[model samples]
Target: MARGLVGFREQAENQAKFFVSRGIPIYASVLTTALEMIAAGEGHVPSVLEEAWKDREFSSPYERALLLCASMRFEALRDSSHPLAEKIGDDADGQGRVTREELDRAIDFGRTLDSLVRRFVQTNEVSRSITWQLAATCFEGDGPIVVIDLGTSAGATLVGDRIAQNWQAADGSPIVLGEEKRARKRYGLDRRPVDLADSDQEGWLRACIWPGQRDRVLRFRRAVEEVKKAKAAGELVVSKMGAEDMVAFVRQIANENPGARILVAETAFIDYLPPDIRAPFEKDLGDFISAHPGRAVWSGLEDALAPVTEGGGKRFPAEIRLRRASRMHVVARCEWHPSVVAIDHAELAKARTPH
Candidate 1:
């Protein structure tokens, strides 16, 4: 467990630097301080780090633990009596420096390791840009479009198409998305789907947001409200299913609506899949596309452009691929959250190569 925590600490430091580069200094500070506490292995660090080590298959233990700590800080920022509340308030600019004493006090006041263990980080920002791009790409298709979201916790991304959001290109040109509401059906598949109406679930969702990111927090709140409205109207359907089941469901939907374009979308998913599962999952998707040509598309915003093999390796230039009939085209290489997108029209125009 200590060894694992060491690995997690290293990953956390990298994540802290990454967030700092992305202008989320609050997250960087939180994660950096969290790393210090974990390295010390004292004062709530053991309890918090212990919870993170439970799942050996967990993809981002450092990130999960950091978010848990940030959630505690967020709660502290909300309360007046908390010792670190004022010091660690929700001011992104104010996250200049966090002392060890403040971190210890905050953790002691907000010790909920069990809740942290049960929760998963499922941010909806990645879906914002993805939905817009999908709308632009498939809005002109023959029939109504069907969207299937894998790892769709709380069904947030499933309803992304209906939400009103704006995005700009790297060149500062406003990227216009298709306004047509052609998404006839939306399905969310998760092994354990979160109930948006449940207060505990809602709290966990809010806790997943990074500390001091007011815009992201506000966007998430709005997304929750939108999801609630959709659920009340019976427009969003969530199933107790995994990625394999989701693929089968997509096939079923395609068969039922032959003319409809079936789009399988996943954001920050796929990386968690074990190598064994990931390989077969890709094969299954490829077979499905081969069996039904020009009828289905897979759009994914994952940590990597391609799935990681048994021997792990790092690749550069993050890209979004639109796969159709077993052919993939690199549409754009986007930032981590895809807020800034650089379209690769030349690469997209090239013949569909093996993905």
Candidate 2:
């Protein structure tokens, strides 16, 4: 848990072993347990946890993180001395139970974990293979593009990808991807407004850094500045809306902008939807494609794992999925072409800045 949540640490190996004993996938044991420790420490239990820990079922790392995240909301409410009052407090307005401040912090932590963990996993050849497989499915095209990011927290990945991407041009010529000259139009959407008010975001971002990786922090900071400049100039726009609203908005945008290529990347989203809710969520994706036809793209990680399992290997379903869904793809690529965009050093350098 500590290793997964906190990044490379001495005890990660032991903790990972502990997780293996429980039949919880090592990835999950580290992440979910770490999240639980953090969430419970902050004073809450997620509504989905009990379900998450249920008997044998596939559980995704992101779902575990989300469950931990959603539960963090109850900390203030659960802190009350009286049970009834606490229950009442739990029922208190969302403001009292989960403040915007807390949510922002939690989400930031979750995203940091997402980024760091991905980096950690990528070090392994197998993980790299998996990433290539997924990426191949995403970056397929001869494309000079306009990028649209969904669930783009603080526009980190979108800007980072743009800054870091190394891909071929539509003419099949190798383009370094970020010359900082391409007039790439970028947009982002999410249900909650991200309060990236400098200091807070930077603090949260810095906390996620691994010791020798301070260099990455510097790069992340530069990328963040680029994004900030873009937003300030109105070249980038991030909207507050739920998944459904986002789909509708994107549909409209895609329809109106035929010549502009769209790329939708949902970093650590898509596992929050309950199993029952996945149909509609997927339907929304399909609908967006049907509406925009070949012009739009959508990418995300889907947690195929069940949330919990009993003591011996009996897996059971939870109210939500736990997988980390972080991928990018174009609608047209799904049908005719599929490829992965390699991250160039320049883009990675720019992306390593402090949030």
Candidate 3:
């Protein structure tokens, strides 16, 4: 997987070039960190890289690997002969190191790209939806409510939502809540085990923040911190299962919770499944929601715009047509069943606007 070193570096340099091009004033320390992470095979690279750079004062190769690896699938970097191709092993002395070959092997740009894109879409939805939903409705009742998040990535989206609903602070700033209400239940389901180990993933998350949007970053960071605390306290739970399994789990949760309202958010996740897989998944999901009857919001690349037509006669709507150049679109759907509930279409429209 090590073939793309030159190209990866080119992209990195391109990124660096972009910063230079726009005069963004990236810290040199950060640049060095980015380089090392990109070059090194293994070590406490990701975590150390993250901890050392928390001040936003440094970025490293490690950080770059985290960012670029999580988001891009550039084929040139997919050589498996590199040092990073396999998990690095330790010597008798307990020191960790990886050869350049390993680094070369470990780089798979496409998977990383998918991960990064998924992350971006989900976080954008949370930033836009969670705070308002919590303030307006989620916490309105007296008793606690259960939350089941399908296709949860690292459970970050669910955790972020709970924090927003339960925490005293407003969406951005850390405003303390006088009320003591808290969500009673939380569950997350996904096919792949979310990478709790990747601090650079967290850091890449940090990088996405607009300078003026400090509060949004803080909100997410705080939510993540809570999950860490819960895990430390032995209260965190996440189910390693895919869409089908998750739907089943939700059914059980619904039966157990009994009238407990549900919050289901699949941020940019459902589109990955082909129609055949998606049909059963969607049907199961629709059934579960219909049975439980609560509020849910789904945001992703929409087939509405690019409908897969039969007979090969048509394409998606004019607006939904995939951008020939970027090939990315964001769409979200929010529903509240059982007679009536509120949906802010305008807010969804604003959130779905392409980044």
Best model per lDDT: 1
**Model with the higher lDDT, candidate 1 or 2:** 1
Model 2 global lDDT (CA atoms, 0 to 1): 0.40
lDDT of 1: 0.63
Best by TM-score: 1
Give the TM-scores of the predictions, in the order they appear: 0.81, 0.45, 0.46
What's model 1's TM-score?
A: 0.81
Q: Tell me the tens digit of each residue's lDDT in model 3 across 1-355.
A: 2222333454466565444433332322123334676466444434433432333321223334335432322222233432332221111111224343333333332344344223432233233224223332423456555666556666665555445532222122343323223445566677764554467555544444322234555566776676666556544566788776777777676677776655554544666676777999877776654443223322232334433332333222211111111122232221110001122345434433332
Could you tally the backbone clashes for each prediction? Answer: 0, 34, 39
**In what order do the candidates fall by lDDT, top score first?**
1, 3, 2
- In candidate 2, position 341 carries an lDDT of 26
Tell me each candidate's RMSD, in Å, in order: 5.2, 15.5, 14.6
The worst-scoring run of ten residues by lDDT in candidate 2 lies at 120-129
Query: lDDT tens string, model 1, 1-355?
Result: 3333546666777877876765657567767887777767757755655654566345554655555555565466557677656544555343566676766666656544544555556555624446334523643445677777777877876665555545555665755655335666677888878887887676666656655666666666677887788777776688888766667787887888877766677766677787877888888887876776555667766564453222122222456766667576667655455555655656555423332
Q: What overall lDDT goes with each candidate model?
A: 0.63, 0.40, 0.42
lDDT of 2 by residue, 1-355 (tens): 2222333222334444543443434223334445444456543323223323343232334333433322332232234432222212233321113233343344333333333222211100011111112222233355544555556656655455434433332234553333322326677776654435565444344333222232344555666676677788887787777776676676677677776655555544555556665577677776665454344445443332433333344332211111112222221111001122222334323222211
Give the runs in model 1 whose Cα sits over 4 Å from its true position. Answer: 1-8, 34-61, 77-80, 84-94, 126-136, 139-142, 304-317, 346-355
